[model samples]
Target: MTTFTSLPPEITREILQYLPVPTLLAFGLTSKNNHSIQQHSLSSLRLGVFHSRLGGMISLMEATADRSCLHSVQMILPKSECRKKDKVIRNQNLRIANVVEKYTHTLRDLEIACWELQESAAMSLAQLKNLKRLSIRLDHPHTRFSGLDPSFWETAPGSPVWNLFTSKKGEKGKSALGRLQSLNLERAGITDYQLTKILESNPNVRELSLRKCVNLTDKIFKILAEGKVGRKLEVLHFTRCCEVEIDERVLDHIGRLLNLKELSLYGCYRLDSDLVKKLNDEQWHIEDLTLPSTPSSPNQEVQIDPEYK
Candidate 1:
């Protein structure tokens, strides 16, 4: 019988990648060979870093030192109230800064959720050179249901925090996020101007999801239709949002996205049959579509186009 130590290094590393983090840590203690395999397996991982401490999801930034080789990192925060006394929340700003400084050059996908704007985290985020997928959720856990102020969306271009991820004037080769393909913003206080800047910065994005963002307005959709931003978009989702009304014309404009395959609009009470007709008439390419379950008025019912299967 062959001993585990006698196995080839490739097989050892492959097996290690699937092991639970605690188990992997335990294996790392067995011998020098096991430690080397564990390090190799962890360096190339794609991790979903949730706020919860469950299952095998360990914080990549906390778990490894050389995390630059990571292909994906999803940072999630609980929608429910986070205890103010928790060390995770208190030291989060410092941890985020360290992670970004350590791995900015090779980082790909990044997802961040902050109860409030921490300058350190914002600055750290700007340093990522190869980020492809970015998901930002910026609402306080305690204030999820409270109405948001409109002025929160009006961000100035000169703001250091906003400028970090954007191209400086006349300093262009490619976008800071040339590799970006997907973006998700939830309750992030995004205004038309800020959204335009982000879209312009990452023009190649194919999938966009905006949820519970109260600051986005109809004019933003108009911009998306008229500008180059929506050209490559294949999937779009807007849910539980205010200020952005999904009227018939908006749907007509969205139909221009030739590559669109999935369109989901949930709790946008303003949507009606007119929007459905436009989607149906234009031969929209959406293969999956979702609409609000409850119409604004008791007499109205949402109509889904049969062609979109």
Candidate 2:
């Protein structure tokens, strides 16, 4: 009598294709046979690694040491985990490093939410040469105290986090981040100069978002308006980034982003009412322009989906 495991490889591939990503992940963890089939059948597999799931994630990584099935990754740390002692956070970073290093060849999209990334894990992340999209969400006061310097670009040699933002120097000058197309950072505490370095390094990034990045000033907008990223940038968001003075000079610079399709400045209170009107009046290519309500108008700020179009 034939069994499901004994089915022909082509039949198994078809069946696995019908299953959703979550189901495939669950079934892959059930046995070696299912894992093999899942790996071969799916072009890419999604992995969600949380503090609670770290042990199981590590075990799976050990079991599939030779395989590179995980493609998209979301690593999130809970509030409780963030509040843990430094030793626990360090251990967690080590585990994250192991998992990231193991799947560098296949991992493409990564979203990390933690108090901050330690150097070890950040270095491991920089090794993902194929990474195309990245999101970093850091908690406020904790990040300030965790020795997480925002000027990663100017860090010392073997600058783990800086490596993620820059291209490796070689004959080809290939960078792990050369393929990046979208970047999002929330509460990053990065200054304009630091961010300019990042943008200059990843000129291919098409979508850029900065939320509560208090250190940014008009200088950043000036860079984008004149930098390589502006040539290709299609989406831009500046939520709660109140320091940027979006005056006529900055507005003119923004108009130079010929490819920009969407623009949002929600919660950026320093915005002048006339600038908003000017943006609306300009004959630009922007398809979506979202702005915070004026002080006279007590309404909610317009919200846009973070996902790129």
TM-score on alpha carbons, each prediction: 0.63, 0.65
- Residue 140 Cα positional deviation in candidate 1, in Å, after optimal superposition: 7.5
Assess the local accuracy of residue 242 in candidate 1 as a C-alpha lDDT between 0 and 100.
46
Candidate 1 pairs with clashing backbones: none
Encode model 2's per-residue lDDT on 1-309: one tens digit a residue: 999889999898777765766787798899998787776555343433444455335433432112244344445556555554465457666767776665576556665544446677666766776777777654332223233454532222222354445543342455455667888876666777667767776778999988767667777777888899988999999777765464345667777888988888777666765567566676674788886545545676876889957
Lowest summed lDDT window (length 10), candidate 2: 152-161
| Residue 253 displacement (Å), model 2 | 1.2
Q: How accurate is candidate 1 locally (lDDT)?
A: 0.60
Cα lDDT tens digits for candidate 1, 1-309 = 998889998888777766765687689889997776766664333433234543114333323223343344444545443344243443455555665665566456566544333556666666565777776654333222223344433321123344445653346643455557877776665666767877887788888898766667677677878777687788888776744365555766776777778887776767774556456556874788776545457778879999998
RMSD of each: 8.9, 9.8
Ten residues in sequence with the least summed lDDT for candidate 1? 55-64
**lDDT, residue 120, model 2:** 74
**lDDT of each structure?**
0.60, 0.64
